[model samples]
Target: MNREEINKLFGVTDEQLDHMAAEYESGKWEGGVGPIVPGRPRIYDEELETISFRLPKSRVNAIDARAKRNGETRSQFLRQAVDDALLANA
Candidate 1:
């Protein structure tokens, strides 16, 4: 998106977006190019799809504890679990 559109979507001012863009261009942020110009399709090597699943509260607590023990966030732990499962199944 253009600067105005990006700012609107992110709920930031144009100045904020510009600062973010500059930071990204300077490689201060980790990955990917920042906002694209309006009307340009975002290209991907392969598309990623998201899914949601339900687990018991206790199971979620266990996962959170395990993640913390491993010094990872819950999301990172879950992603690692998925990757491991895929590799094992393959």
Candidate 2:
């Protein structure tokens, strides 16, 4: 979808967009699109969905240990595991 579509989806007004645009064009704006926030946000390349499943306690412990050791999050470790499994099967 386009900027207008996203704006409409988020209930952003045309005047608001113009104001933000003006701020950016005039070099007064720092960063971010619409609202002012605290720290840097988590940006992803694509949209993500969450799923839940129950695993053995031991298995979860193993995952957490490995993730910490590799300096990665649980989600990252699980995504890598899924990708590797898929590629191996293919």
In order, candidate lDDTs are: 0.80, 0.86
Error of 1 at 11 (Å): 38
User: Which number leads on TM-score?
Assistant: 2
> 50 in model 2: Cα distance from truth in Å?
1.1
Scanning candidate 2 in windows of ten residues, the lowest lDDT window is 34-43
User: What is the per-residue lDDT of model 1 for residues 43-89, given as tens digits with 9 covering 90 to 100?
Assistant: 44677677899999999999999999999999879989988999999
lDDT of 1 at 59: 99
Against the true structure, what is each candidate's TM-score?
0.48, 0.51
RMSD of each: 11.6, 13.9
TM-score of candidate 1 against the unseen true structure: 0.48
| Clash pairs, model 2 backbone | none
- Candidate 1 stretches with Cα past 4 Å from truth are 1-46
lDDT of 2 by residue, 26-81 (tens): 76776665654456565566777889999999999999999999999998899999
